[model samples]
Target: MGNSSFFFFVFCFIFLLVLGTCDCLSDQEKDRIDQLPGQPSNVDFEQYSGYVTVNEEAGRALFYWLTESPANRDPKSRPLLLWLNGGPGCSSVAYGAAEEIGPLHINSDGRTLFSNPYSWNKLANLLFLESPAGVGYSYSNTTSDLYTFGDAKTAEDSYAFLVNWFERFPQYKHRDFYISGESYAGHYVPQLSQLIYERNKGVKNPVINFKGFMVGNAVTDDYNDYVGTFEYWWTHGLISDSTYKSLQKTCEGSSSEHPPVECIRALNTAEMEQGRIDPYSIYTRPCSYTTSLKRRGRYPWMRGAYDPCTENYSNQYFNLPEVQKAFHANITKLSYPWQTCSDIVGGYWTDSPLSMLPIYKELIAAGLRVWVFSGDTDSVVPLTATRYSIDALNLSTIANWYPWYDNGKVGGWSQIYDGLTFVTVTGAGHEVPLHRPRQAFILFRSFLENKAMERSSISI
Candidate 1:
């Protein structure tokens, strides 16, 4: 058929190849945010938010918001970090994105957003996901699916979401990936990490490229948490000595998730003794607004900031029709407004292991980077609780306990275990970034670099 025919065939092949690539990218581009409705004008980074259907039969979809590092930072060169907030039913967009590590922070008016100087996106391409189909903007066509949500299914659906999400944002398919979260995500980050690690066992250079995970103020083992919590309350002078003794006697042997009547009574007594303080951030003033919603979960609600009313701002900001439109959320026009946590889902959580210590052992032995951090001021999952959980692991010490500094002041303390690293943010609360953004930023940078927190007083 000669030169003309061969050359024509080659041209057609190349044209189709280019066209197909463009077609694939167009799907991702559709989800891109040209600008958020109330986003700051000086912003010069790309952002995208949308839903990825995880289950077609049940019509379940999970929502995600990606905040890329500024162009000046060369976002393409950064690792991809996925952040989840655990209520077993919380919205990562509300907690992780709006307030904590994401680029935008909601204003008091709840309509406009301001730049977060210490947003995690500056260090990595940050992705916040709301999972389990009943939290925030994520939804299920089959209503019953919400009530049956549990650990195993949540992990499976999240894995599916990642698979489908990669198909849309193929550029990140092979990027270095890490999972992180706080509170109940103590279960999430590790469980998901285990699943990814197990699935990619024999495959070399898998698309997910999951390297490691980190959790802050996480719920680890029930037994350790109970012990540590009661101890913290007693030591901090929050609970009466009698209440502490009762808590130790009644709760040590009981399940933290489903306590017996005696344990519940003890907990109630402890609460009464502690009074009206914000248990999540013991030293901070509680939200004065009477209408502020408290999350009903196995664990207490984890919020960001010294101002306890931050969740109220998120509730107001995310419900705005224009904001939802910009986020490509609420397409189904749900019967309920957006909430920080879903009571139905959290209340109905079906299966949670008594301990995540075993998963930690497995992952650590498998050579994945495992880091655990605690915001010292968080009473919900306090530093004492984290310490107890890590002590249970009995991992060898790589670096002895040492104070880490930022800006010529003690930011926190650190200890490097043989297979895991542990950190404590000095005065941060349940959500470290909200309470201490600069120190949290440094902590994140150290986690990504797999280095110990700075021992020197010099600031980065």
Candidate 2:
């Protein structure tokens, strides 16, 4: 049984090993994008967009788009950064991918694309997910699932998506990973971070090497947000003294999600006083008269932008048959058109913790890198509100408030606390990258490098 038998066994083992490796690679290749319908011909990065079924029984699947770093960037050495956009019902693909930090941007014609020079993928492998079936191209077999979605369910589904996604792209399974998002994602980024952190307990080097998370213009503590928002409105001269006082009396201690009748009335009065302005970015011109009107009724608290009709372009581009086919999306041929944010999901949101402050405390104690950033001009989730929420944490300051520079100019102000870093992008809106891509790029680099923002006049 000597030489012949041993050599035969070794050859079979080698054959099986190579076969298994090929099979795994083929599974990943199924999701690869040969090219997008309107993508630039000169693109040098590998892009993949497809669905990963997270719940077979519920027929729930989440859609994801992964844009690897450009060829010269040494993508293997880069961290995998997952970007989410929070509406409880928004598409990260729409807000984060297309308009914010993704490599390709949709042009006004909705049938062409342009390169985003400051795309985050220039420094990291970027993954944008449209979570919680029923948003973007993601869907659930049961229609009712659309209306019952909430924070907890969204986080659970996203975690599941990540697990399954890693199986498809096993190469990234053990890569350093970070999650970042804006707006309601303030709730999402931390909640998911805590889940990953808790689940990995006692396990040796889990597949998900979740290192940290960052959120911009996020919704944190309700009480602090309420106080800070009212103060912002007053200080920014966007509300009357009477309306501000009314808001304070009625809104204090009230849940922003489910405010009392008096609070609702006060909010309505405040809106009237504030008038026809883009509440999201008070400093920028509204997208258009018609677009602003269309958005006003639906997203009173959270939409619009400085780029004006960027959302409209995303909506138009994503709904195209060719674009959907290119993205491997809308295969089910859903009855409705793709929207930037899902009204059904957002309107019928079932549950949200009144505060994310506890989660922050928990993660901070766990020694996860946490950063909270705000676009100083975003009235929707303004800098003042973020400041108020951070103040409530009572962590020891590592670096006192300092002006962080970008290209010899004050990009923003930053403060490094015991376990959290708070940053403000000076002229940005709720979607910082869209409004200020260069500064946002610098901010992202700093976050990933775990370095303080540049204090010198020279840019990195």
lDDT of 2 by residue, 358-454 (tens): 9999999989999988898877778888898999989999999999887788999999999999889998988899889999999999898899988
List RMSD in Å for every model shown.
4.9, 5.1
Backbone clashes in model 1: 0
Candidate 1 per-residue lDDT, tens place, 401-442, comes to 999988789999999999999999998998898999999999
Give the TM-score (vs. native) of candidate 1: 0.93
Model 2: residues with Cα > 4 Å off, grouped in runs: 1-25, 289-307
Q: In model 1, state the lDDT of residue 101.
A: 94
> If scored against the real structure, what TM-score would every candidate get?
0.93, 0.93
Per-residue lDDT, model 2, residue 219, is 86
